[model samples]
Target: MKTSHNFKLTAAAVMLASALLTGCNQANSSTAATKADAVVAIPVEAVLTRQGQISSSYRTTATLEARAEAEVISKATGIVQKILVEEGDKVTVGQLLAVLDNERQQYSLNKEKAELSRLSSELKRMEEMYQRQLISADVFEKLKWQFDSLQASVSLAELALKETEIRAPIDGVVARRYAKVGQLVNQHATQSLFHLVSNQQLEAVVHLPEQQLAQARVGQQAMLQFAGMTPVNAELVRISPVVDASSGTVRAVLKVANAQQQLKPGMFAQVQLQFDVKTDALLLPKRALMSTDNTQTVFVIDSEHKVSRKQVHLGYQADNTVEILSGLELGEQVVIAGQSALKDEALVNVVTVRQF
Candidate 1:
């Protein structure tokens, strides 16, 4: 009976051990299957890196100005007989703009002409006498001198009469009209009679930091922006040789063409001065740039769709593009979207690929 009982106990112990082993095997298989079916590829949006042109630009505030601007003043003193032009009148060069009273000037001119004619007749008679030895050489010379003086007086009087009409000195719009009909004006007047400006040729004047003088140069491209207006294209035309002592800034002038007359003088503008241009530069979308601890980083996707963190040196930045000085290559895929949750060596499925 003791033997039989020991056998039963040993049999029961073996059965329990077999059951535990089977359960352990099933658990191992399930865990293996779960591991094999785990998700690996993270969804991301990427762009192919490329070599392109990039510009290093400096942006500064500026003012739009007419290339040609002047204040017109009268050269003759007289009453403003007829104000031919009003404010905002467009006039061509030498177009009559105003007329002054010229009764006194015309009368004086006529009198001078009559005197000159008389002098010429007298000089002719005296010359004939001298040729026939009927007059003294001294008398003939004196008469000739008198005739020349009278001729000069006539010319002066004619000029005075011509000055009665005021003409536009340049092709432009009359920005302001300061004189009216019957108004007395003089050559010595301090104030101008008209303000003229040409919109055909425009300019953008910007004051930049003195230190940027070294980078500034003529012929570089510029962009002029104003509120509610399309941007105007311009080029750098002038740079101050000396810095402004009070402001510690340098004045830079950009030549602009306002053929449509859209840009006007004294309009506030925002200027982007493209000082430097780089061609065939390695470039990436700006969205791919990630900043951490003041460091710029980007994720580079390899052929296996695995992403790796890369530190890059930045150069010129234009719009939505950035120049990569180092740590990237052409044709490499850069993760621009869904980068916030990326990890090093993480697999990614590029759901969308954008052209550079």
Candidate 2:
């Protein structure tokens, strides 16, 4: 009886041991499976956050104009006798442009000159008579008045003769010519004979929105770009004081030096006005920022190859780069591409590293 009782006890102990060992092996297998599932790394491209310079700017459409423009008109009236210049001719101020018929004016001036000579001889004789007391003071004074009137008439005739020549009023390139040889032109018609433009310096005219008036100031640097041309530098020259009632905007003018005469008037342009610049700013590539539900976040990678979403504050944005005001450090790696599959505390495999 004692041997049989001992055997039963040993058999019960063995069964308990076997059940515990099986449970322990199952737990180990479950742990291994979980680790294997979490070890998969998300492939991503990343960039190192850097310190650099950034600028805030505004862009607007503008039209180029000449430094000075004028509509030229003739002051004399007669048949056009000769045309000295054509369109696109460069002329100086007071340069003769055309001539009118002056034959009648010349004849009138010669007749007036002869009359003045006769009056001067009579005045000399009258003065002699007055000195000898043979004529009264009133008679001498009347003869003097007659001679002065003839002299004035001759001066008027000379002025009329000179008016037959048309001259340029400003130094510029002639843009148009409305009169030709043998064409009749009149002074009172109120028509422009030529369009003159001074193109040594070009100007860009733009209407800035009223909200930007505080930032727009004279002497600021600007950049101008046109289709099929390289960008050029310009300076802000003028700003309108009053807002335009029709557009609710202020007019700003930028001046550009065209020493080589490559820029012409009436070219459409895109102007970039720089408002502010920052040096040594924390910057990141614009693609690194992800916007979700009005919230901006950046995926930052750690030394262990894990990514975490970090909320950031942004400052000035320039081109493809953005200034990071907070929540990021210089030299930290941020995922720039292949971010769609990333999550918090996710393992990542960096395929490429780029410098911002």
Candidate 3:
């Protein structure tokens, strides 16, 4: 009877302990539910979508060239007497550049002039004789022809004398000089004297991909920058209709006014061909975008600081800025930096806001 009484007491005590453990579990479950309701805010950098200017352009490289250039050569064969201009001297068309040995040419011109003077007097006397019937028509005609021939010889001699002087054929700056004093140059021989280039206007020929031909047009504005220089204004002046089969490119010509003459002929330049432009465009910094699986998205923050993933359509992209085509509104807050860790409905603690 004593054993049975102890067993019954133990059973009652076990039941009380089990009931206490179950109540504790219920209280812990309520506390866990409360903890689950609290959400941590993610820190992010955001920006406001705003209206701005944007442009679409194609980039290419081209070597600059002078629009006007010439190779100065000697037209007469003679020893170079004096060099009037050195490399880098400015010259105009018809400007005397160099003198040649003209003693021989001068002597020939004087001899021809003396003979022509004598012939002129003789022709006058013969005409007077013919009028008096002292000379026949055939004889007078022969004498007149001789005078005309001598006149032609005098003109030739005068031209030969002028050819001894070298002149600039174009307005430009002398780029190179090949002739020196006492150097014998032959007109028949291909001897280069000086090279001149005009930098008032410059040209750059760029090869555009066949795909860009449709976007190219005359009078289009562009910008060009050399390796170590600031960008300058340029204009599209020409486009070749034929496409090169080997390279699959179309030839394009860009002209730039170099009134300051700061650019050179062979300098490599980066060209930005502006095909389209928008003055009032809805834009966002390119950093505000998330690219996943080839789909572009942005995390937009609502009034409650909760972020939602929005699908965005993009248009022309300029430096660091992209045009928003759809799926966004003006003045909407978007997470730019620190958005990689965000998801839909995630609470955000905005750290910084900036404008593009």
Candidate 4:
């Protein structure tokens, strides 16, 4: 009887402990289920579309050049007697650039002149003799040819003497000086006496990609920015029809009037070309853009309090806002903040929206 009672009491204690453990497990599972039903919500900002012009501008680099440039060289071989203009000197057309030793050329001119005089006197005597029937017609004709030939020689000698003095071919500033006094210049040599650039009008040479070719044309206005000078107005002067094979770019020239002569050639410059203009377009802050694998995407809040991923096509961006080309509509809510933790189809609760 005692063994029977002890067995019954031990069985009762084991059954109670098992029931307690099962109840505890059921309560824990219920608690976990309740916590899992809770929905997480994210805060975001939204924007509305409005009517305003948005410009798409492309920025490019360019170099300043003179509208007109010339390399002054000696046409005739001679020793430079004097250099009248130095580098950086402003000169006009026909101004003396350098003087060459012309003793030999001068002597040649004098000899030609004397021969021409003698030929003219002889031709006069021949004409008189022919009229008086003292000389034949053929002889007079021969003397006339001789006189004309001598006259041409005199003119050639005079031109050679004039070439001994180098002159500025254009009105410009002497940008470089290559020859000095007493230096012998060769006619066929590659060396130039001076480099002149017209500063009255400056040009900026810019390389444009194929996409920008349509927007660039002659007479279009543009803005030029240099390192030290203020922004200047420029007009498109020329454009190359062919694209460079290696670079795939087209060349464009912008003409800028340098009335003050402050702009110089070879200076670096920045060029801005404006293209499309949208009067009404949906714009979102640039910070709102989310990109993955170079594919741009954005997060939007749907009507069901769920987050959804949206792919968007963007256009010109300015003032921190990007133009939405497609995949988004006006008055749609976009996740601008707390997007890092949100996933697709996740539930959201709007805390507040940013007003812009």
Candidate 5:
């Protein structure tokens, strides 16, 4: 009877221990389930209002061109004897650029000079003889006329000799050289011996839409940017009186002083022309707005912990931000980064706040 009681007591203790362990495991599983049902935090960003400047500006691309350009061509036909200036050399007006072989021309001029001198001496002798009645007046007059004709011929020959030398007509840099030594050129030839461009001033021509023509006028300030250089000041010099019928655009020429001669012809540049300005306007990041057809909307978080889609009228956009004309007030939180994943009245947890 004592062994049976001992065995029964041991069995009861073991059963109680197993029951306690099972109840503890059930409690742990229940706690785990409760933790799993809790909502997870979603990553989001908010928009904040800040003072921003909106300058009404137009952007366009233009090509740089020299104020004056000319193609230097040969004025007379002859074989090129020498080239005085090479490419990239600075030349002034009337500076000798090239010389043609003038041996034949020089010989002709020398012969003319000799004949003119001889005729002049003969005419003087004839005039003295006629005054003294030694020869007829008609004979003396004929000699005098012959002398004058010879003198005129000599002058013409001298000018033709000078034409053998090519000279620059403008003060500029030689951009190109087309004729080489010993090459034959024709008078008034279309082939350019040198291309010269004036570097003192530069201009850029940009096209503007006809609707904006009224806003763009002469004397408007502009900013220009080119490759390998910083922004430079420019001004609206002229606007084309005629507009392109097909494109509906007008050309505007911007003049800029090139004191350093750094800007060259045919270089592309970016131009910014400001037309208007606004103050005390609500601004938001351009990315925060959504558009469909003619309806523009932005997602705003209200005080009820839900996202509300509001339609907004936009004003001027400057520096990647758009002006909020209406339908939204200052200090209202707007979703900038995650608006595509949101809907009207959707539950949201503000994870981050950022300035837009």
Candidate 6:
């Protein structure tokens, strides 16, 4: 009886041992599954590749100016009698801008004319006498000389009378009026009566670095932006071949359109010159670039929700966009944000899909 009881106790102990081992195995398997489900997916923002326009650009700042300007000065010393145009008034070339006192000039011209007429009658009589041998040759020559001198005097008098009128030298608007009515003015450079500026077209002279001298060319397109205004289009019309020794810069002139006369001279502007353009090229935001070991790289997201590092070749960069020459294709997703924490083959949770 004792042997049989011992055998039963051993059988029960073996069954309990088997149950404990099976329970431990089940608990370990459950813990492993829970840990696997907890693997983190990093959040990131990405953009799909697309075709767009890009250009290689150089940037600079300059001051706006009138393409054509002139300072109208008095040609005769006289009092300002009649003013025709005021500041902000438009005038055409050769249009009368102001008139000076003409009483003295007119009187002088009339007197000279009368003298010329008198000399002409005397010279005719002297010629007749000389032809008939009734007057000496020397006397006839003296009369002819007097007639020529009187004619020259009349011409001078006429020119002086015409100088009393001030005219517009260029087609432009009066920027300023210096001489007031009844103000005495002199015929000198310092005494400018009116300042004229043509705002139908404007210009900005920008100095480019000597390194960009090779890219500067006439007819190249550029953009100009003013303070609190819409950006305007401009073109490179002239470029100075010689470089400045002091500044290491090249002089370039840009023509800007101002048909409405909204832009003025001496206004500051920001300039961006596009030397090369690539239309229908693959473009990406400049922020998407990643610099790694002296080379440029990017983080790409595959359809499996994993990120992979890629090396890209660049073409042109402008306006915060860069051209992707190689290592990417159309319709691929590139991580633009949260890429700093990304690694190859790492699982990702796309937080946002943005446009390129």
For model 3, the stretches where C-alpha displacement exceeds 4 angstroms are: 1-40, 129-145
TM-score of 2: 0.80
Better of 2 and 4 by lDDT: 2
* Candidate 4 error regions (>4 Å): 1-48, 131-134, 188-190, 278-283, 291-313, 325-356
Comparison by lDDT, 3 against 6, better one: 3
Candidate number with the higher lDDT (3 or 4): 3
Candidate with more favorable, higher TM-score: 2 or 6: 6
Worst 10 residues of 1 by lDDT: 33-42
How do all models score by TM-score?
Answer: 0.84, 0.80, 0.85, 0.71, 0.68, 0.88
What lDDT tens digits, residue by residue, belong to model 3 across residues 69-136?
Answer: 99888889999999999999989999999999999999999999999999899889989999999999
| Residue clash pairs of candidate 1 | none
- Cα RMSD (Å) between model 2 and the true structure? 5.3
Q: List, residue by residue over 147-191, the lDDT tens digit for candidate 2.
A: 888889999899988888888887889988887788887889966
Q: What is the C-alpha lDDT profile of model 5 across 1-356, one tens digit per residue?
A: 99999999999999999999999999999998876543422345888765567767789999898988899887678999999988899899999999998888899999999999888888888888898999998888888888889989999889889989899989889999998999999886667889999887889998999998988879888889888899988899999999999999998999988898888889888899877777777898888889999889998887866888999999888878988889898888888877777888876778888865
lDDT of 4 by residue, 1-356 (tens): 99999999999999999999999999999998776766454555544443356677778888888889998888888999999888899999999989999999999999999999888888888888899999899888888888888889999999999999999999999999998988998878957999999999998888889878887768777778888779998888889999998998998888989999988888888888655667787878777689998888888888897888899998877767788899888888887777787889987766767755
Candidate achieving higher TM-score, 1 or 4: 1
- Once model 2 is optimally superposed onto the true structure by TM-score, how far is the C-alpha of residue 275 displaced, in angstroms? 2.1
Choose the strongest candidate by lDDT: 3
Candidate 4 positional error at 286, Å: 2.5
lDDT against true structure, model 1: 0.89
- lDDT per model vs. reference: 0.89, 0.89, 0.92, 0.84, 0.86, 0.91
Q: Model 6: per-residue lDDT, tens digit, 1-356?
A: 99999999999999999999999999999999877654658888999989998888899999998989998888788899999998999999999999999889999999999999988888888899899999999999988888888899999999888989999999999999997899988777458899999999999999999999887789999999999999999999999989999999999999999988889999999999999888899988889999978799999999899989999999898867889999999989999999898789988889999975
| Model 3 residue-pair collision total | 0
Write down the TM-score for model 4: 0.71
Candidates, ranked, lDDT: 3, 6, 1, 2, 5, 4
Q: Per-residue lDDT for 1-356 in model 1, tens only?
A: 99999999999999999999999999999998776645567889999989999998888887778888889888899999898889888899999999999999999999999998888888888889999999999999998888889889999999999888888989999999998888899788655889999988888888878878888888999988899988888999888888999999998889989888777788998889998999999999999999999889999999888999999999999989999999998888899999998899988889999886
- The 10 consecutive residues of candidate 3 with the worst lDDT sum are 33-42
